[model samples]
Target: MSDKALDEEHEKYIKEHSALFANYAKAEFMIKHNYISKQDRLDMAEKQEIALNRVEKQEKRRERLMKQIIPRFVLYFAIMTLIYLFFRWLSMYT
Candidate 1:
């Protein structure tokens, strides 16, 4: 296609999808920040729901990681303590 024709087509396409592009930008911004600022108002109900869900999902993932980390740390400490006690007792007998 010629440059002028291509330009016109591009402009038309953008005009048709302007709302879609705006929504995508908003969603991208929200995902990066993980929360909307007080100054930024979410006009659409769908956008609000998506933000709430993302925040909740992050919290759940954090809780899961904490649960896993605490148990592993306690198990490691317990094993090390047992090994130290065993060596001390063996040295005393010998």
Candidate 2:
């Protein structure tokens, strides 16, 4: 009930869950006050790091699939073209 007691309780809450409190505060400010804080910027940076990591993983997967597919397609096309030319020459001679 006393201001000092409330302050102590608030400090304890902050210490126990600093990251959660910081995120909640940022959300509250963005929603209610329509203002961004320093903590919000830090949170955005952290989220960007996660997003970049996800994008990097996706790109690696795309590269691996491309590596597998390109050679197979090239080989298939070359075989098909050779077969077509061989048939065309045989038909002309017959």
Candidate 3:
């Protein structure tokens, strides 16, 4: 192919797939250079902060539910234990 025709073809290919080409080139460059940008570090920190907040909210909700459940459970167990002891005492007497 003539040089002019080859250049035109390459330009057309780049125009047609500009985004894909840019992404591929960026990935290749990052792999070769092993460098992370400040923006990437900031984004990672933001994501970690969001995740920590979500986990903390979940833990607070779990603790609230546990607080409600534990007393009910303890009350139920105490009543059951008292009933069992009363039954045993009556059986022994009779």
Candidate 2 Cα errors over 4 Å, as ranges: 1-43
C-alpha local distance difference test of each model: 0.71, 0.72, 0.69
TM per candidate comes to: 0.53, 0.46, 0.45
2 versus 3: better lDDT goes to: 2
* Clash count, one per candidate: 0, 0, 0
Which whole-number lDDT from 0 to 100 does residue 81 have in model 3?
A: 100
Best-to-worst ranking by lDDT = 2, 1, 3
- The lDDT leader among the candidates is 2
Candidate 2: lDDT of 30? 77
- After superposing all C-alphas onto the true structure, candidate 1 shows an RMSD in angstroms of 18.0
**2 or 3, which is superior by TM-score?**
2
Q: Write the per-residue lDDT of candidate 3 for residues 1-94, one digit (tens) a residue.
A: 4579667855755564575446556755765686767676566557656755765675687578769878988999999999999999999989
Question: lDDT at 86 for candidate 2?
Answer: 99
Candidate 1, residues 19-90, lDDT tens digits: the string is 555766786788578776544544554665675576567568757876997999999999999999999999
Give candidate 3's TM-score.
0.45
Write one digit per residue (lDDT tens) for candidate 2, span 1-94: 4579667855755564566557556766675775777787678768756755765675687578769878999999999999999999999999
Please give the distance, in angstroms, between residue 13's alpha carbon in candidate 3 and its true position after superposition.
Answer: 48
